[model samples]
Each structure stands twice: as C-alpha cells, then as structure tokens.
Target chain A: MEFYPKLKASIEEIFATMIFLDLTAAEPLAAGTEDLGCHVSAMIGLSGDFNALLGIHCPAKVGLAIGSAMLGMELEEIDDDTKDALGEISNMLAGGIKESFAGENVNLLLALPTTISGKSYKINTPSGSQRVIFPCEIEAGRFYIDFKYSPR
Target chain B: MGKTVLIVDDSNTMRKIVSRALRQAGIDFSEILEASDGQEALDVLAKNKVDIVLSDINMPNMTGLEFLKAKAENAAIKDIPVVMISTETGADIIDQAKALGAKGAVKKPFTPDLINETLGPLL
Candidate 1:
C-alpha cells in the first residue's frame, strides 16, 4: 500500500489541530538522502501485521518550535519537554498511520515512543527493508516523518 | 463544587496538551490531576477524588486496556467514567475499551470542539 498520502494527511491534521501550525508537504525524500540535518528524533516500533519503525526527525530550531507550540510554552532548548513532545507526536502519527491501514483491514500494535537527540547520529535499517521519509515544512523549518517497514 | 479530572498518559507533553484542550473546550475543573501510566493513575485515584478520567490506550507500565480491566475489578473506582483520548481508536480496541467500561474515545489530533463534544455529555 502507498503510505505516503496517509502519512502526509496525518501530519497535516496534527499540525493544524494540535500544534496550531500550518504546514506544507514536500516531495518524498530520495533513499540516499535520509538525513535532513536533524538534531533530534523520536521513534516508536510497530508490530502485528507488520514490523515497522516510525519516526519524526527535526532540526534543533524546528524541534523547539514544534515543542513550544505543542505545549503552549516557549522551549529555549532541546530538553525533556521537547523530546516528550516529539515522541508524543510520533506516537500520534503512528496511530494515524495505523488507523489508515485499519481501513484497509491491516492491524498494528504500537510500542512506547523513544527519543534520540545530539549533535550527530545515524539510523540504519536492516537489509531489504523499505523506507519512506516524508518532509514537512512549518514556519520554523522542515522536519521528516520516517517510516521503515519489513516487506510483508 | 468544581470537578477534578485525571489525565493519564506517559508523555508529559500530551498531559499538558490535554489540559490545555480541556480549558479550550471550556470544561471547568477545580483541579486537574496527572499520571504517566495506569499504575500511577490507580495510585492517584486512590489518593484523590477525581470526577473523570481521560486516558491514552498505548502506554508503558500498564496499557489503557489493562488499566480498564484493572479499574473494572476495583470496586471503589469501577464506577468512575473514563473517556479514552488516543490514536488507538480502531474498532476492535475501542470495542474492547467500551466493553471494559470506557465511556467514549477521542482520537489524536483532536480539536477543542471534538473534546467538548465527546466529554461534555458525560460531565
């Protein structure tokens, strides 16, 4: 199934209603350029019908912007609140994706979300895995919603 | 007298957002309590008098479904109303939640009006 549109709609709805931010969807990033200079990332694992990892990657400024907007407080730096905010967003995005799939009769279970942040880091998926990184632009900057899944 | 509501979710960000959304929804509450997981929610319920519960189904320590089952088993808190606010609002899960005593559900990325609509009648 083509998940890009489903994921994109989820992103739009989340930003519109919860974060109170307007965003535009960019073209899906090419495979080789998965890195978007992201300083922070939040990920959650999925199981059941398929095994997958869903993540939201953001640069520092964009992360702060999203976190601040989500919590209705200004976030000066990447802290627990920022991580938690992104993680919850990841969780919500995954849920949206799951709901989309459920419409097609796919079942999925979600794991608790986790965050990764620093000056530098890399995420490597297993060989033969499929992945898509959807870029989204808000006022502060661009962020990516990444979905990697094992071929069913 | 004003009502007290417990917001249960692992994410501090979500708890804050739910609280803010409740205010935006124009729901008045004397105090709002928080818990990161079902166990913590149980602990809070034991210690405080919460009029309602808004919970997330996917969580660590104890999931919302497990929490519902546990809450059903407990005589003291069994009758308190719980409305799920989560992304896990699939028919099977929601049906299970309802069977376990969840009053209703509000999906993630919800608006203030949606929150008010789902939770207003119960209050």
Candidate 2:
C-alpha cells in the first residue's frame, strides 16, 4: 500500500492544481464496479524496471466536469475533448508515479495513453500483476484510479 | 508578422492546453501548427516555416526524442528551437532532451507563466 498513498496524493494534487477540483477517496465503495454503467477510461502501459498498467476511470458526468475544467469550457458529452482530458490526466499520473521512483534505480517507460468511453465494459488485470483500485469522490461526481503492477 | 509555433503531442487535449498557455503567455503567434507525433511534426516542418516547436517526449509512432534527433541531424530544421513539454520530470529525460539539442524542457501541468519563463529566452 506504499504506492497507494502516493497514488492518492498524486491524484489529489493533479485534480486540485491542474483541474481546480478536490478529490476525496470514497470508503468501501471506492473501486466498486457496480456503477460503471456509463464511463470514460484512459490507460497507459508502463515498462522498464517494472511492468505496470495505470489508468483512470470516470463517469460521464465527471468526465465532462474534468474536460470542462481542463479546457475552460463546458463539455456536454464524452467526446474527443473528454477523452483528451482523461488522457492528459493519465499521462500526469504516469509522470507522478515515475517521479516517486526517482531513487529506486528503476527506469520506467510510459506508452501513449489509450482512451475509451462507453457503458457495460470491464477491465481485466494482466496475469501476475497486482491490481489496486481506488474510488474517489470529486465535487462533480466520482472517479477511480487502477494501478496494476508486477516485476518484469 | 508574429512568430509561428508548432505544437506536437499525441493527446489533443495537451496540444490545446499548450496552445492556450502560449497565447496566454502573450506570444502573438501568426500561425500555430499541430502534430499528433514527431513524424507528423516533420511533415509539417517540411513545408512550413515554424519559429519553434513544443513537443512531448512519449508518443505513438515517432517520439519527441526521436524527432529531436532527426531535427538535429538535418540542417534544414536543426536550428529551429525545440522545447519539450511532458509529464516526464526525470532528470535523465530532460538532460537527454537537452543533449539532443532541445532549447528547454517544460514539465506537464505547466502554468502559463512557467511556459513563458522557460521558453522566453529561446524565442
């Protein structure tokens, strides 16, 4: 859980400073998959000292809010604008995690982020990777971060 | 005529943000060109007279570093100032960018002032 705390902090910092939103990690319901009915997702593949997958999942409403905040405009749907916002945030998360590993002597390579928006889809963790999901509450709606990692 | 800028990033959102920051920095760009990756940037560079390039390090197809190397090797676009903008805060990455002939490196989630301060000298 060492990375979890840092992950939480990173998420909060990014949301607060970059998007001007505040995030509070939801308890119990955090990481729950029940309400992923309509959502937006962005993921980046990490390689090098360790292989991992890091991603962000947000509901449509939350995605809109994030997109609007990022672009200084109002977004009504999960369109290209919304996907781009999530992708940038995902990239930031990758960088934040990389910064945390500065003294670890491990070099991490982050692939370009992949984004999708829809309903009734599920994400699976790769074999031998530990998946940790954190559900978070934002002013507009809820979102989550999924970090899956395993030594290569 | 104002300066022309080339913004390169795989994420459309990032390109927009950087463009907005540049505008906010009080840089009056005559034309702002965009590219999804380094290869696309090269395509744009071949025909356009861009004053500077702001690129991201990690991208699909051709990366920013690869593009920078290409720019350095070619005399035509070698002198165009390149400023790297990315989530990569690592020293090695920034150092490598500088070594590859980047004029400056701007960390992601950057502020308009930071962008201006870092890229101002190069311009």
Candidate 3:
C-alpha cells in the first residue's frame, strides 16, 4: 500500500489541526546518531497483524507550541503536563488511524508515553531496526516522525 | 439567520475556546448547548432542536466519529450538521468523517478567526 502518502497525510493533519501550524516533510534521513536534542517522542506499538511502531518526535519548542495551542499555556520550560500533552497527541493520532482500520488485522498496545532528553535513543522494532524518519519543521522548531514494523 | 449549535467536548479549556469562537463567528442563537461526550450529547439532542453540532473527535466514553455514526443511523439525528473538532489531521479520518455524513470539520487549538471562518459559511 502507498504507505508514505498515507503517513504524510496523517502527520500533516496532526500538525495542522493540533497547533494550527503547517508541516512540510523533509528528506528521510539515513540512520544517524545526532543528539535529537530536547524533544518529545510519542510511541505507539502496533501489534496483531501489523507488528510495527509509529513514533512522533518533536523538540521542546514544538512540544511547547502544541501545549500553547491546547491549554493556552505559554511554556518556556518543559513540564510534566507538557510531556503528557505530547503523548496524548500521539495516542490520539494513533487512535484515529486505528479507528480507520477497525476490525482489520492490526491491534494497538496501550503504551504510556515517556519523556526523554537527547537524540541518542533508538526505536527497537521488528522492522529493519532503525529510524526511518521524516523531518518536520514547525514554528521555528524542527522535528521528525519515524515508522518501523516488525514480524511476529 | 439563527440556529442552535451544540458544542460537545470533555475539556473546559477547549469548550471555552470553542464557545468564544462561535460567538465571535456571529453565531448568535436563542440557545447554545454543551455536552461532554456522546451519551451526554444524546441527552441534549433528545429534546432540543439543534441545527449544528461541533464536537471534539476524541473523548472518553464516546468519540465524535462514533457519535456521528450513531447519529447517522438515526433518522431524526442524521440531518443535524455535525462538525468534528480535534487535533487529529489524518486524511483517512477526514474522509471517513465525510463519508459518515459530517457537514464539516475543524481542527483543534483553534483560533477565533479560523474557527469562525471554517464554521460560519458551513453552518
């Protein structure tokens, strides 16, 4: 299935609606070890017929921008609620897609979102075992959404 | 020139923003009702003659999509325009909503002007 187009549309929708921002996709980076810096990563595990991971990565600035959009809060510094909002957004996006594929082969694992610093971490999935990432820039902050799937 | 609009969502923060924006859009009505979820919305829709519905797509017991679907199945409820509000931007989701017979859709973290612009003509 034309997955890239689907992913592109989904990511763009999330950004456009969530924070009232426009998102254009950047090049897919070859796996690199750059410190991803201060960002929020939302991970949703796809189980059942589709064994994979859908992850959203955003810098502190993007996270704060989202928070600003929802809570009307101006966040200069990241806080627990800020991180929670990012995680909720990923869950919502994932849930939206899951609803689309309802009764299909895929199942969702209700994973809690974790906040972390640095860009050194990696997603260990059944698929090729690297970040197949797409760069996204919003409100002066740059981020990425990475996807990978694994076999049972 | 006037019609009732029901705004449904769980968050007070979001509800306030939506109400303010609706008012800003010049959507003055004799009645404006608010519901927190599908079941709550059902209650409001039971007797009230609402012309338009603005709902958050994601909520605890019932979601906007589900509400839309259920409303579609009911003859009395189907005609009322349901506009989904959320942070979700999936194309498939939008298509699904349109297919389910949504009159319109708006994304979250809304600006008064944007909300008014998207909803005004549609309503």
Candidate 4:
C-alpha cells in the first residue's frame, strides 16, 4: 500500500513524459480476485529481495491509443504495435519499482517482458502472495496495474 | 556527414521511443537500424556502418553488456561508441559498462533532454 503512491507517481511521470498521456488513478480496485477482464496484458517477473510479478492490464482500445501516442504512428486495432506498447509500459513500471527500491536490503532483477492479448482471461497469483490493483483512467480509457509479491 | 544509429532492444516499443527521442533531439541520421538482441545487433553491424549503438542492458539471447564487450573486442566495430539505456540503476553496473568501452550509460525512464545531453557530444 505504501508503494502504491510511488507506483502511481511513476506511472504518471512515464505516461506524461514518454507516452504523451496523462493518467488519473481511481479508487484502488478490489484485489485478490481472478475474475478480471484483460484484453491486453503484459507481465514481467521480479526476483531477488523478494519474488513477485507485475503486470499492466488494459483493454484493446487503450493499448492502441497508447501505442499510437507513443510512436506517433496511427494504430486502429490490437496488433503487434499495441502489444509492444503494453509490454513496454509494464517494463517501465517494473524498472521504476526496482530503481526506487534498489537501496533496500534485497537485490532485484526484472525478467524480460511478455505480452498476452485476448477477449478476457484470468491472472492467477500465488495464493500466499500479496496482491494490489491500481485502477487508473486515461484520456482514451481505463487500465490497471497489478502488483503481486511474496518474500522468497 | 549524416550518421547511422542502431537501437538494440527486445521490446519493439522501447526501440520506437529511443528512435523518436533521437530524432527529437535533432540528431541527423542517414539511417536508423534496429535489432532485437545483441547477436542480431552484430549482424546489423556486419551489414551496415553504424555510427552509434543505443542498447538495453537486459535482453534475451544477448544482453547489452555482452554486446558492448563483443563490440569492444571486434576489430571492425571496436570504435563505434555505445551508449547504454537501461532500467539498471546500479553504479557498479554503469561503471562496469564504462569499463567495457561504453561511451556512456543512461538509466531507464529517460527524458528526451537526458538522451540529448548524453549523446550530443558523442554525436
């Protein structure tokens, strides 16, 4: 929970400076539920001080919007461009988190980012992991950043 | 003389952002090449005369540090200045990159101005 504010600030800075979009966070979403609709999802694993997973989940439209804005290339649908944008956003988030917590007791490394896109799917976290969801709204649409972590 | 720059990153999106930043920084380039990893970057270098290499530290197949070391050891590509742009923020890693013959290192979530300042003199 303490990290969510830092996470929100990081997302805002990245979107405003890198992607040319401004994001507004909504009330934190209910966490620990597998019933989520993710049209586009990009995930990167965290290792070191603690083991965890971080992901960006958004609808197809939001993904396309972000891709188009960041690349200055027109994109109308969910394609490689959109998927790549989603993955990079998640990558940036994971990297930001790692950098912010670098001085902590544990060392962390981020895994390569992977993207998945579909109508709807469930992301199951380890039962013991602590899960938090930060729901945010952008000019184009709404998206969510999911953080799941557990001490290794 | 116009230059040629190669961007090496596994994520296509990060590559786009880097390329865009370079363009926005007013760096004139005759060509901008891209590769998914270090080995692919070597292949690109084999075929093209790249003036600068912008790379990510963590990638599949071959990492940026590995690529920089390879470039340093190669007779043909040894002089090409490499600037590392990565999420890695450790001073030790940056120092290691410098030791491996990197011209400079920029941490991730970089702004356009940061990119400009880092690469301007080298370019």
Candidate 5:
C-alpha cells in the first residue's frame, strides 16, 4: 500500500478527533526537506515489516492550547510538561497511522517524541534524505509534522 | 478502600496526569510511587508495595520492553498488573506488554473515566 495517502487520511482523522480540526496542506512535503512552521515534534520508528519515521508538528500556539487543555491550566511557558505533552500527542498520531497499515505485514517501534521548540527548524533523517515539511494552521499558531519513510 | 498505585513513565507531564486522574476519579490510593523507566521500575518494585502499574512504552536508558524482561525473571514484579499508555501503534509492543504480564492497555489522550473504567475494580 502507498504510505502517503493512508498517512494523509490518518492525519485528518487524528486531528479531527483529538484537536478538533481538519488539516489541509497545499502539497505533501518532499521526502526530506527542512521547511516547517512552529510546532511540536513527535517521532516514532518503524521496523520489522516497516521501517521509517513518523512525526506530528503542531503550531506553537496550537500546541500550547492543546497542552493547556490537558493540564487544566493556562500554559504561559513552554516548559517540560508542555513539551512532553506534545511529544506524546505526536506519538499518538503515529500510532493512529500504524493501525491503518495493519495486515501489510509491516511492523513498528515507536520512540518517545523528542520535543523541539521554536518558530521553525529543519528535520533531516537517515532514512529519507528529504524532510517532508508539514505546515499546520490553528487558532493559536501554526506548526507541521516532518515525515520520512524507509522500508526494511 | 484506598488502593496502592505504581505510576510509570519518563514524562513528568504524563505521570502527573495519571496521578491526577487517579485522584480525580476518586480512586483513593494508599500510596503512589514513581519510576523513570522499566529499570528504575524494577528497582522500585524491590522496595515498595504497589497494586497497579501504569506504564509508558518508550523511554531513554531503558525502554518499556527492558522492564518487562526484568519482570519476567523477578517473581514478585511479574505478578503486578501493568497498563501501557502510549501513542505507539505497533501491535507487537502491545502483545509484548501482555506477554510480560500487563493486565490491560490504554492509549494516549485517555480520559480519567477511561482510566477508572480500565483499572476500576482491581485498582
């Protein structure tokens, strides 16, 4: 099965269900290009049947709002808790995608999401030379997930 | 009756959320303990008395699998119920968690009600 369309569907489902948004993009970022908006990064490793990296990058303000909603407190600073929450969120989104790939004989190994803060950054991976830039817009701010895939 | 809880996860955010959820659920617990990863969790088992363990699968230093391996050998830790919470979609990992003696599993973005429902009577 092709990964991109399934991935896109998965992203739409995850965001709609969890964050209450419908994510749309001008186009899927090329395999590996370091061009993304402000967001949280959650990456998981795929191995066994499938080997690749999946991540979710949410705009900073959106991330904060999500964190704030979870914490039951206003998030003024992007501290340890906020970063961890976003990482976990990214992890969940990847997990959501994995379910769609079942029966493909592919497997997965998810890692703890490494939280990155800032208005922008570049993601380079060993698997895919080009980073797929994800630009997300929300009420608070904009962010995107940088996705890369490598088959074993 | 207050039960004993063993909270497991590397993230302070998640751990605290689990703890707060437990409290929010009105599931009074006699004691609560923290373990950073599976290794520390095993070490923790050596000293503390806990009823249910809520764990996260991935971590630095020691992933959740490492803890399960240790649990298989340790006669005592093996019996304690483990619940995994992660955004990890891999079925193998979930199977591993069960094979390692986890009682049940709950995904991330879990509500307090879900926690109560999953661990309610036993916890």
Candidate 6:
C-alpha cells in the first residue's frame, strides 16, 4: 500500500491544528536528491512490521517559525526549545503514520525522538533502502518530511 | 477552589502546548504542574495534591506505562485519575495503560475541544 498520502495528511493535520501554520506540499523529491539546505532536523525510528526512519528537516528560520507558533511565543533563535518542538513534531508525525498502518494490521512501535541542529550536517541512509521526501512550504520557507524504510 | 493537574512529558514544548490547550478547553484549574518524565511525575505527586494527570506514553526515564504500574502499587496516590496524551493511542497500548489504572487516553495533535471531551467527565 502507498504511504505517501498518509505522510502528507499527517503533515497537514499537525500544521493546521497544532502548529497553526499554513503549508502546501509538493511532489516527492527524486531519490538521491540532496538535502534541502535545512539547518535543523528531528527524527524518530519505527520498528515492527517494518523498520523505518521518519524525519522532518527545516531551515533555521522555518524551524523557529514552527516552534514559535506551536508555543504561542516569539522565538529569536534556534535553541533547546526549538529543537524540542521539532522533535515532538517528528514524534507526532511518526505516530500519525503508525496509526495509518495499524488500520491495515501493520503494527509498529515508536522510539523516542531526537534532534540535530548545526551550521552544516548531512543524513545518509544505507544503500538499497527506499525513501520518499515530501517538500512542504510555509510562509517562512520550505521544509521536508522524509520517510525511509526497509522493505519487509 | 480549582483543581490542580500534572502534565508529564519529556518535551518542554509539549508541556506548554498541553497547558495552553487546558486553558482553551475552558477548564478552570487553579494550578497546572509539570514533570519531564514519569519518574519526575511521581516526585511531583508525592509533594503536591494533583487532581488529575495528563501523561505521554514514550519518555526517556520511566515511560508512562511504567509510571502507572508504580503508581498503582502506591496506595497513597493510586486513586488519582490519569489521562494519557500521546501519539500512541493504539488499542493494545491504551488497554495496557487502562489495565494499569489509567482513566483515559487522548491522541497527539489534539485540539482544545478534544481535550475537554476526554477530561471533562473525569473532573
């Protein structure tokens, strides 16, 4: 079954209800595309019927905007608060995807979320793994939600 | 006097969001306490009088299910009602929580209205 729609819906629901942000999703990026020039990212691991890594990548300004809206405060810079916010968002998104899979009897367990933020960094997956990167746009800029998983 | 509620989640952002949602739900609570994980929640419960608890399932030190088991054994605080707020609302997990003494569960990405609906009856 296709999981891309589920991922897209999860992003839309989270932004609209909790983050209070407007976003439009673009087509999934081609496999092997470069990182989205994002300064911060949050990821969570999933295991069970299948093993997968789900992540949300955002530029500094975009990350701060999301954090600010979520907390109902203005954030000047990317700090612990911003990282924590994005991490929680990643957890929620993973949960959303997990719930969708559950409907089809594909059970999954979620790990705690972790964050990575710095001037320069890159994420690489093992060869032969499958991935889908969804580019989403908010007023501040663009962000990506990538789901990479091993075939069962 | 208004009720005092405890929110247990590792994410500082989530704790803040839950606090705001409680207010938006129009549930007047005199105080809203917070703890980063279930272990901390136990400490807070030991010191203060919390009317109810909102907890997350996955946490670094002492997950929510483990907290429920510990809370159940402590006669002093066993009776206090707990409602889970997490992305993991699958039936199996929620059933485990309920068996361990959790009163209810609410999924993540929830709204003020949903919070009220789940927590209103218990208050």
- The best candidate in terms of lDDT: 6
**lDDT, residue B112, model 1:** 90
lDDT of each: 0.90, 0.84, 0.68, 0.84, 0.69, 0.93
Model 4: how far residue A45 lies from native, Å: 0.2
> Could you tell which candidate, 1 or 2, scores higher by DockQ?
1
List model 5 lDDT by residue over A1-152, tens digit each.
46666666666665554444545644655454465555455566656565667666765677788677656678877777788777766666677666666656555655556776666755544444534545655566666665666556
**Residue lDDT tens for model 2, B1-123:** 799999999988888888888988997789999999999999999999999999999888999999999999989999999999999868988899999999888887778898889888877
* Residue A99 lDDT (model 6): 98
lDDT of 4 by residue, B19-115 (tens): 9898888888889999999999999999998899999999999999999889888999999999999888577788999999989988778888999
Error of 1 at A31 (Å): 3.6
Candidate 3: residue A33 lDDT (0-100):
53
Q: Which of candidates 3 and 6 reaches a greater DockQ?
A: 6
User: Whose TM-score is greatest here?
Assistant: 6
Candidate structures ordered by lDDT, highest first:
6, 1, 4, 2, 5, 3
Candidate 5 clashing pairs? A31-A130, A32-A130, A32-A131, A33-A130, A33-A131, A49-A106, A57-A144, A59-A142, A59-A143
Clashing pairs in 3: A13-B89, A36-A119, A126-A150, A127-A149, A127-A150
- Candidate 1 Cα errors over 4 Å, as ranges: A121-129
For every candidate, what share of the true interface contacts is present? 1.00, 0.76, 0.16, 0.76, 0.54, 0.95
Model 3, range B35-100, lDDT digits (tens) per residue?
A: 989878987998899988888776778877888888888898888888888754456678888898
Question: For all the models shown, what interface RMSD does each have?
Answer: 0.6, 1.4, 5.6, 1.2, 3.1, 0.4
- State which docking tier applies to candidate 6: high
Docking outcome class, model 4: medium
Encode model 4's per-residue lDDT on A90-142: one tens digit a residue. 88888888877875645788898898887886765555448777788888887
TM-score of each: 0.94, 0.88, 0.58, 0.92, 0.76, 0.96
Cα lDDT tens digits, model 1, A95-132, are 99899998898889888899989875455444444888
